[model samples]
Each structure stands twice: as C-alpha cells, then as structure tokens.
Target chain A: MELQAIGVQHPAVRQVQHIQNNTAPNRYKLFVAEGLWAHNMLLEANAPIDTFFWCPEAIYADEAHRRAEEIAARAERSFRVSLRTMEKMSERDKPDGLLSLAALPRWEPSDLRFGRTSLVLVADGVEIPGNLGTLIRSLDACGADCLVLTNRKTRLTHPKVIRASQGTILTVPTVEFEETGEAIAWLDRLRFTVLLADTDEAVNYRQADYSGRTALVVGSERYGIGKEWYGHGYQRVAVPMLGSGDSLNVSVSASVLLYEAKARKANW
Target chain B: MELQAIGVQHPAVRQVQHIQNNTAPNRYKLFVAEGLWAHNMLLEANAPIDTFFWCPEAIYADEAHRRAEEIAARAERSFRVSLRTMEKMSERDKPDGLLSLAALPRWEPSDLRFGRTSLVLVADGVEIPGNLGTLIRSLDACGADCLVLTNRKTRLTHPKVIRASQGTILTVPTVEFEETGEAIAWLDRLRFTVLLADTDEAVNYRQADYSGRTALVVGSERYGIGKEWYGHGYQRVAVPMLGSGDSLNVSVSASVLLYEAKARKANW
Candidate 1:
C-alpha cells in the first residue's frame, strides 16, 4: 500500500477545510465526502477523486480496510493521516476516517434528458443543506429523471447535504440554474407539465395527473411557490394536511408528492 | 406585564440546563420549549406552564410583546432574562427571545382513545431526535389518532425533537412503551390491525388495507423491526424505492404512509 502519513498542516487537509464554505467549493471545484458509506458510494458511482485520506487504526474490520485500500488505489493521490488530523478534516463529530476530495461534476439545464414518461424534481429556492440533501435522496429514490435547483442558495457539493443524502448526490443527475425563469423556460420547451405543491386553490395531489412528462416543484418551507410561477399553465396540488401543523417538512412534502406520481404512473 | 429580570446563575437557568439530558426531563416532569412558535402552540393546546422567560430586546414587534405578556399572565412565574442568558438556555442558534419551562403532560397507553376508523403511528425504536420530531409533525398533520413510541431511546421532550417538530409535539397525543412486545399487545387487544413498514417479503404500501382501526409502525434506519414482531400477524408493507438509495428517511417514510392512509380514508 502506497500510504504515507500526512501532517495537519498538509495542503490537502487545508483545502478540504476551506471547501466547506458556500462559494469556496464552487471556486475550488472541489468538495469533501466522508465516512465509509459515502466513500463506497463514490467508488460505486466511480466519481473522480482528487485526494483520498484514511487513518489505518481507525478502520477496524479487515474487510473495511481492504475496501479502503481498493478505494485508495483508484484515487490520484492517497495518504494516511493521524486520527487527530482526520478529526480536524472531518465534518462529523465521530469521524469514520475515510475522507475524499473530489472534483465537482458539472450538470447544466441543457444536459437534462427526459424520457417519454419522465419525472423531474424542481427545488425552487430551498435553503437548508440537510433539507436539500434529504430531498435529493427522495428524488433519486422516486426515480426522477433529474433534479433542478432554481434560485439556488446552497452549493450542490455542501458537506451537510452530501452526508444527509448518503451519497445519492454523487449518483443522482442534478443541475442548477441561477433563475427560476430559466428552469421554467426549459420545462416549457420540453413540453413537460408543471405541478406546484401549493396549498391555496389547489386540488388534492391524488387527483392530479402524473401520467406523462411532469415536473414536481417544491419551494422553501417558510415561503410557498414564487408569485412568478402562478400565471404559467401550472397546476397547483395540495398534500392534504389534516391537523394544526399546517405545512409538512419540505423533504417530506417532496417524498409524498413524488411517490404519489409514482403510484399514478403504476396505475395503483 | 409582571416580568422581572433573572440572572444567569439563577436556579431556574441551571434547572433548564440540567433537564437537557435524557432522563432529567421526565424525572422532573419538565421540558423546555423555545421560540414564539412553540410558545404559541403551548398556549393553543392549553398546556400547563411552569415558567416563561423572554428578553425585552428579543420581542421585536409591539404586538409580539403583547402576546408574550398574555402568555406570561397564564404562567405560574414569568421572568425576562438577558439576551446572553436566553442564548445560553435556548437550543437554537437564532433564539426568538422566548423560552418556557413547562410541566410535561403524562400520557399513558390507557390514555390513547381511538375512533372506529382510527389511524395511529407506532415508531418502533426510532433513535434520532430530529427524525422522531419530524415524524410527530407528519403524524399530527395526517390527523393520526395517536403516536405510540415503542422501545424509544430519546425522551419525548428533547429540545432538538421539539424544534424539529415545529411545536406539534405540544399538541400531538403521544405515549411510549419500553418494549415492542407491550406495544404489540396493546394494538392486538385494541383490535387494531398492525401494518409494519418492512422491506422484506412486503407488499406495496398502496395495497395494504388501512380501512378500519390501523396502527402503522416504522423502525430504525439501521436495524428494522425486531424478530419478536414477526408472528403477531402484522401486515408488512413497503414504500416502493425506484433508485439506488434503497431506503427512504424514516420521517419521510412515515409521512408518505400516513398520507396514504389519510387519502384512503377521504377516498381521494
């Protein structure tokens, strides 16, 4: 194994720490993915890795060590760091000793490919990284063709999102647009019907049709869909909330809606 | 407004800090609820309050101060703590200048009252406080009759769970059983059909019958339902996952299932 211990002051460690910021990840074109699960996901997705670091003693099981070695073999640069050093570079309180810095994969609006009965998810101004990540996992689980983040605040490679998504971010085809208008135009040009999860003047989600090409749009929890989305030929559907907690968590809302679409698609 | 300023080293502040642990909240029969939203929820539910704390500067609007004063009038004792003290006592980084120590309501399994067509949630060994909180919110939104926590690890009044639940924890009818066997026996005796959210040998959730008295149970993400639950004649149902991430977040899973039950109940 070509493993050499690196110091806390290593440039690679510094880079990983700096990339935790909102803009630095995009600026550096690098992001951090930690833990054995995320590492395995990166390996499964065959994501490009710039630097891979692991602590020898931290990996307990022999099989896990073998897998870590296999992952290290695929990386451009590999190093062994002290447990303390690993802790400094890790985002989690309990570090699993596996950390990777990989080049961010770029996906644009034009890159989104839709099938005859495609299902897409549009995150219109989602702010929280954990919520955004959970939505990505749900979107991927629902087999959505693509996820488009409009009026984006959090970077696609945010560590909290990466952890919360459990590496689905690496596997799912996700893209971002600066403005919701761009996303709207793309949907319009693709002949995809838009369904907004709005509470007012909306039909029950079960009654809404998701038989053909459809894009399910969910907005921030605090604010409903933007006013600009109203005039368009979009149908608003509400997930029936029966009690005082008037609004569901954004991630939960997305899951129910996507699964409802899946149910309709299957004729259930 | 009978609001007196309290010091950081006050007994009440220390007491609040002590109750942050798992056992202390229940031992003392007290739990902390922070922010205006939770405060309002407690008032709406007419929950018993021990003490209410707020900062003068934290109350931004005159109307908000008036409401705080009205809530304080109902409390046994009311005090205004400095912003610094409030920050220390508050669980959230952005404190809304409202914190309350309230008497935790005791709800036993016997207290669970169900209708003829009751919908119930059984969180079997759900460990994460946030996930549990989100489940409470979703369960409340779907108008489930009650939430029965089986083999629960976290206290019902954990600050993180309360915040994540968006004060729904204050309103939802919830009870806990130390053992899964007890929960199963309770459901069986009540003639409530048990629907376990198990991925193995499970039918699609849509196909499961939630027509009459039903108790939908979800397990921990790491370890699913225990083996003891197998021979109880519980129906196993799976939420169809279409992509690489084989499992949905526990909270999201519960929301979709409860909403499905709600949809069926309404015939939508």
Candidate 2:
C-alpha cells in the first residue's frame, strides 16, 4: 500500500468536496465520515470504505492519528493529502486529518423486517439535518428496530445528520419512502399500529397504548404531520403543553413518546 | 412620537452590535430579539422594550409591518434605519426589519417562589446557547415554575439563546448562580428534591418519584453533573440508553425528564 499525495486540485479531493456540498447527483450513493468518532464507528461496524484520506499535520490527537492509520490499513483505497487539501475536503473549520467516503446503506420497503412487538419511528418532512439526526439518535436510544423516513426533506447522508446522531446513523436500520401513501400502506400491511403525534382530538400520550407492533410518527416544526397521515385509522396522541410554548421541539417530542412506548412495551 | 432616523455609525447601533457579538461588558443587562416571532412573543408577554429598530425597505410581510407599527407605538424608543443599516444591526443574513433591545429579566435565588408540588429545572454547566434555549422552551412546555442556571458558560442573553428558546427565554423566570454550592444550599433550604441525571448508581427515570417539590438537574454533554452535586442526598436517575450512542443530547434528556416530572405531578 502506498500513500499517494494529492493536492487541493486533485480530482478525488474535488469529488469529496462536491459530496460534502451535496452538489453531486450520486451524493446519496456515498457519504463522508469525518473526525475520530465517526471513523471509529465506521470501523467498529466494519462498513465498507470507498476511500480514506488523512493528513498527519492536521490531526491534533494521537487517538485520531491511530484511527487514521487503522483506516488507511483497512480501507480499499487510501490517499495522503496536504493540510490545505484536507481542509478543502473537510467540513469543519479544523480538519481532524481522517476522512472516509463509504457506501450508504440503502433499504427499501421490502427490506424492513419486524418482529412481534416491534418498534418503528417514522419522521415526516423533517427539514433540518441536525433535527433529523437527533431524531435518529432518540430512536436508537429507545432501542427502536427501524427508522422509516417519509416525505423526507433532508438527505440522510448529511454530515450534520451523521455527527448529531453520534454515528448511530451508520448503524441504525433506516428506510425511506418517496410517498407518504406508500409508507402508510406498508405499515398497515405489516399490522403496525401507527401513532401520530397530534394536538387536536388526541389522547394524552401517557394514556395512549404503545403495546404491540407500534410505529411512532412525528412531523417537522414547520408542518405538523402531513395531511396524508390523517383521515386514516392511525391513533393520535399529544404531549401536554402546559405553558406558553405552542409545542416541544420535534426531536424532543419524538424522544418523549419513544421512551414512553418503550417503557410501556417493556412494562418497566 | 416621531421615529428617529439612525445610521450604521450610531452609538445605539454599535452598542447592539457589541451585545450581539457578546463583546459588551454589560451584555447581560440587555439582549436583542430579532425577527417577527420573537417580537410577537415579547409583545404577548408585555415585556419592556428599551428600544426597537425597524427598516421599511427590509420588511417583506404585511404582518411584520403591522407588528412593527404596534411595537413602535408601545416601545419606549423606536428608530427607522436604512436596509443596509438594518442588516448591520440584524443577526440573520436577511433581516425581517424588526429588532428589539430589551432589559433581560433578572431573577435571584431569593426571588424564586414555589408552590406545593412545584416543578423546577436546574441546568448545571450547559455551555451551548441553543441547548440552553431549547431547555428553557421545554421547561416552559412542561409548565415548570422556574429555571436555575448554575456553572453557566454561555450568557442567557446570547442571541442564539433568545432565538432558540422561541422567546420563552423572555417569559421563563430564570436565575443564575455564581457557585454550584450556592445553588445546592438554596435548593436544600427550599426543601426541593434534587434529582441529578446521572448514569452511575441511578434508577430508571420512569421509576423515580417526581411527586413532591422536584428540581430536575441536567449537566453538559462534556462534563456530567458537578462533583459537588453528588453525595449530598440528591437522587440520581438515568434515561435508559438502549443504543450505541453513549447518551442523548442534553436538551433532549432535559425535556424528557421535565415532561415525566410534569406528568407525574399532574397524575396524568
């Protein structure tokens, strides 16, 4: 294995930068994981890495350097780049000297599998990459089996999504739907009880039954859950807003409901 | 009342810019609220506005214009400025033609009042402005009585804090402590049960007693609760983390705990 030195104008560097900017059409086909935490999680999951780029001068931590070395050894292709080139390819003001472009795990409706008493989370029209990522983290914390994104607004491969999720975005089983109707139909076929977080004609979230196969649905701050999700047999539940705030942050609402569902299901 | 025309070089403009940059020594004495949502909130709360600045050319919405007029009529002082000058005074890239410099509500430990079965939140060492703001929004949502910030890193008057809080930061009675020991002693004296969100020797949060006068304490993501807070008869409780991530976002954790305490207190 040889360390090929690349400059700021290198095609590979340009490609990563375009992917980071999300200018590339195939951005969803691949994603970049920067910093030691995301890279360690990638290695821990043994996810396939298309390429690894490192700059010894940019990394400040010994642990990051070690992880970069480990990644260089294991990556299918590895490149050594100058600090300037690394900065061009990095998202943060300070580059950690390690970056990996890896294949994003793609799942379809058919790929989603469920068991008895399965827990699933459906995030609809969540625009903020950080919020989407935080929702995924909450879903993971509740030991939810899968995340199904419908009416998706932000790319799942967004760097903020990966970082805010604490790298669980790499490990969590996630699927996306192009249309809300498709997701509703699939969940209905699977007999998963769809619970929509709504403010009107809704039961207290605590009083709602989360037992059996459950799919907790939350919407973005701008738009409540889509109109398509309504008029269906889905149960509507509301977290009590006792003060001046119109509602809780979307991620906060989702986490509270997810934990409640998990507790009720486990009889904790 | 005639509106005084101002320029970018005006002392008031420079003072606001300094406060926005958090460079002013008395930054905590006044805070800026930008855009329509925060302005509407301030008006709804009847919060005192020391000064209001509006740009006719920059405002695009009719509702915003109406709100600006309403603010100008009620504000102690109002100014008309050029769009470029408004941009200089505004935080966002595109200013909504409204900004207010208002006196930050100052509360002290002695000012904190509680009722039987009161709910309070103590954020210890939370450094992120947005996280602190979101915690305040959650506190408001949970109908918590007051917010006590100890080991505070970011100013409560930070622009991001005011914005992220959805203006609840203005209404939520908040008090700050210079020392963690002072907060501890005050809570103890008040007979408020202090529950620390900790991972060690902690019971499941769902099983914890949130019935009496409860103060839910959360710490920064970097540092857990201060060591001084422990071994002082404070209860330790943990939200179950059933994922690869080490912990949830500080705001998410705080919101979950706050809602749980609220629900338990209301017997919902």
Candidate 3:
C-alpha cells in the first residue's frame, strides 16, 4: 500500500480540522472518525470512505496495521501524515494513529422496516450529542427497529455522537423529522402504540405492554416532550425515581425502557 | 443581609481556584459543588459546608435568593464575589454564580446498613470521574443501599464527579477500599450474592434472580473485573449487546442492573 504524504496545509487536512472543530458545513456531508475502533466500525458498516490518515509510529499492533492496510485498499484516497499533523487533526489529547473521512449515509422513512413486535425509539429535541449517542447504543443493544430523530438539536453524524455511540451510530438506521407531530402521525399510521416517557399520570414502565409494535418517545432533559405530542392518546409511562431526582439522565431512562421492552419480548 | 466582599487575591478565592482545577490535595478535605441544584442537595443532605460564595446579580429568581440566603445562614463562612471572580471560580462555561466548599464526608464499613433485599452497587476500578458520578446518580435513583467504591481511579470527591452526580455523591453513602479483594471479602462475609458483569460464560442479566440481597459488581471498560475476582463463588451475568460495540457504558450497565434488581425487589 503506497501512502501518499500530506502536509497540514493540504485541503484534506484542513477538512479534517474543520470536522474536528465542528466548523465544517453540513453541505460537505463528510465526517472524521478517529481511532482504530472507529476505523474497524467504518469497515464493518461499509461506510463510504473518502480518505484514510495513518501515523505509522502509533499503530504498533500487526493486526491494526493489516486492518489499516485493508482500509487504505478500500479507500479512494489514503495518506500517511506526521505525528504532529495527526495531533492537529485529532479531538482527543492522545490520537489513536488512525482517522478516516466517510460520507454520511442518507436514510428516508421508507428505508426503515417495522415488524409486529418492533420497538422504535423516537428522540424528541435531545440537545446533548453524547446523550443522543448513548441512546443509539442502547437502542441498538435492545434490537430496536430504528431510531426516528425528531426535533434533534445535533446532527446524527456529529463526531462526539458517533464516538460516544462507539460506532453503533453508523449501523443504526435513523430518519429525521423536523416536527414531532409529523413523526407521531407516521407512527400512528403504522399501527404502533406510542408510549411517552412523562410524569403525568404515569405508570411503572414495566406495566406498560411492550410485547408488540411499540414506539417510546424520550424527550429533552430541560423541556421534555413537545406539547405537540400531548393529548394524542399516547400513554404516559414513567421510570420510577426512588430518590430525589425528578428524572434519570435521558440516556439511562431510554436504556432502561428499551431493555425492559426487550426482556418482555424475549429478544435476548 | 450584608455581603462579605471578596476579590481574586483572597485566600478563600485561591482555595476555590485550587478546588476547581483539581489541584487541591486530599489533605485539604474539601470539595466544591457548583450550581443551584447542587446547593439545594447539599442543604437537604446537611453536608458539612465550610463556605458559600454567591453573586447577587445571578440570583434573579426569588426562590433562588431565598435558598442562597438559607445556605449563607448555615455556612461557617459566606462571601459575595464580583461576577468576574465568580466566573474564574467556575468550571462551567456559564457560571451559575453559586459555589460551596464542603468538607468531604467520611464513611466506613460500619456505616453501611443492608436489608434482606438490599441492592448494593460495587464499583471496582471505575477510572472515569464522569462514569463514577453517573453511577452515583443511578444508584441513588434505584434506592441502592450504598455505593462501595473499590479500585477507584478517580477520587469520589472529584469536582467533576460531584458535579456529574448532581451532588448525590454527598447524599449517597460511599465507602472506599483500595483493593478489590477487600471489597469482595466484605460482600462474602455479608453473604451477598455477587453478580459480576462479565461476558465470559455469562447468563442473561434479566434471567438472574435479583430478588434477594444482591451486589452487582461493575468493572472498568478496558480491563474488566480484576483477575482476583475470578474463581470466586460469584455468578457472571451479561447485558447482551446486539450491536457492533462490545458493551454499554459502565454507568449505563450498572444502572440497568440496579434498576432490574430494584424492579424485582419492588423497592421503588
């Protein structure tokens, strides 16, 4: 594998810096995934690779080099940058020696498939990228049908979100809706029972029947589910907080509900 | 109420800076809790608060000022600092304008009281302050008897841990053991069923019986339960991950198990 030498002033290098700083516009549709695990995830998901950056000194493992070689082979462009250049491209204090730029996958509502026993997670207005990413991992672990991102504050492909999800964000199917009502209406048309996680007249989450097609609506930590989602015949269920906190972290709450549904359906 | 004026050069101000930077030694026996919610939790828990700092301009809400006044009345030392100095003392981007220096609570093995159906979360080798803080909140939410900290990489009173735990670190009883063996032996002497979260020959987490006195042992993400934990009469349980990622975040995993046990024990 021939490694193309690059400098910090190169357009591709600048692009990586932009992506790391989150200054790059969405028009680029490019994401910077850092570290070996991310490289493997991009490979496993067959993400469209635009470029691969490597630091030979940092990648000591033979298996890692082989995987990087494979990635380079699959990419349209690849380069070997100096450790200092790699440092500038990395968001973490310690760069993991491998980084890749992949085109974000586009998904439409039709791309999702829901079954009679499907569990879909509808995230409404989640501001924290880390929380959204954690939710993706939790949803994926429980085998949720797909995540419908409605009223999202951060892009599904944000670097922090991608990293926090541990690359599960790449595999999980996601569709975005600008309005919560539109998302709810789509779920209603699909004959899915929507359970809004709210404190009003809420029942223990375990009591809510999750055996069949279900959609759990999790809201932001501050504002909660949009008022648009209220009074739509959606059942309100709460994760009982036995202590002083009014709510659990949004990600933790979603995971608990997802696992409960999975357990009831015997998905594990 | 008269404001005790202070400036950047004040000795107390220097101490706040040291605590925020995490440069203060354990010998100081002081931790800073920032923001309004943390202040309230400190008040409710009756934590030994040594000092309180307030910015009147930031305390706009009537209820907030009342709470600040209440805190000031109870504190041994209280001062009003300029907004600029308050910003310097805060770790948050937008300082909430309230900071408290509290004496770290000391606990021992004898402080823990377990019921027949008690659920205890044993955090072994949890290296991240954020993860430890989240675990404290999760365990508190599930009404776990206490969190036994063993093989901890970060201090339980780390500002980030306290901030992440939303000051629950003060309310939740925590006893630390320098070694994992000491923690395990204590659990054994109490006849607690130690369920270690490991992927090796593990049963489904949901399939495990968590109805009785149970202690779920959570390990670090990189190096799971130390080798010393093996060969113990402990059951290995796994939270199934159907995604490309290997495991859930440590805090998320422990919360799931803690809630499961709480749900089973009907302790909610």
> Which prediction has the highest DockQ against the true structure?
2
Better model by TM-score: candidate 2 vs candidate 3: 2
lDDT of 2 by residue, B1-268 (tens): 3589999999889988988887768734798888888888889988889889988888888899889989998888899988999888888988888998887788877877798899999999998888898899999888999999888889888887887788888778998889899988888888899999987899999999987799999998799888878888888999999988879999999998998889889989
Q: Could you tell me the lDDT of residue A203 within candidate 1?
A: 94
List, residue by residue over A1-268, the lDDT tens digit for candidate 1.
6688899999888888888654343554578877777778888888899899988767766766877888888889999999999889887787886788986577777766788888888888888888999998998888888888887777777787887787788778887777778888989899889999998889989899897898999998778677767798689999888888889999999999999998888766
Regions of candidate 1 where Cα sits further than 4 Å from its true position: A23-29, B2-4, B23-25, B94-96
Show the lowest summed lDDT stretch of 10 residues, model 3 chain B.
B20-29
lDDT of 2 by residue, A201-240 (tens): 8999999988789999999889889999998878899998
Screening candidate 1 with a backbone cut-off below 3 angstroms (N, C-alpha, C), the clashing residue pairs are none
What digit string (tens of lDDT, one per residue) describes model 3 on residues B18-123? 8767776756468888878888888888888898999887666677788888889889999999889888888888887688888878878888788899888888
The C-alpha RMSD in Å for every predicted model, in order, reads: 2.0, 1.5, 2.4
- Please give the range of 10 consecutive residues that has the lowest summed lDDT in model 3 chain A: A20-29
lDDT scores of the candidates, listed in order = 0.84, 0.87, 0.84
TM-score of chain B of each: 0.92, 0.96, 0.91
Interface RMSD values for all candidates: 1.0, 0.7, 1.6
Range of the 10 consecutive residues with the lowest summed lDDT in candidate 1 chain B: B20-29
Better of 1 and 2 by DockQ: 2
Stretches of candidate 3 above 4 Å error?
Answer: A55-65, B1-4, B27-29, B56-66
DockQ of each: 0.82, 0.87, 0.62
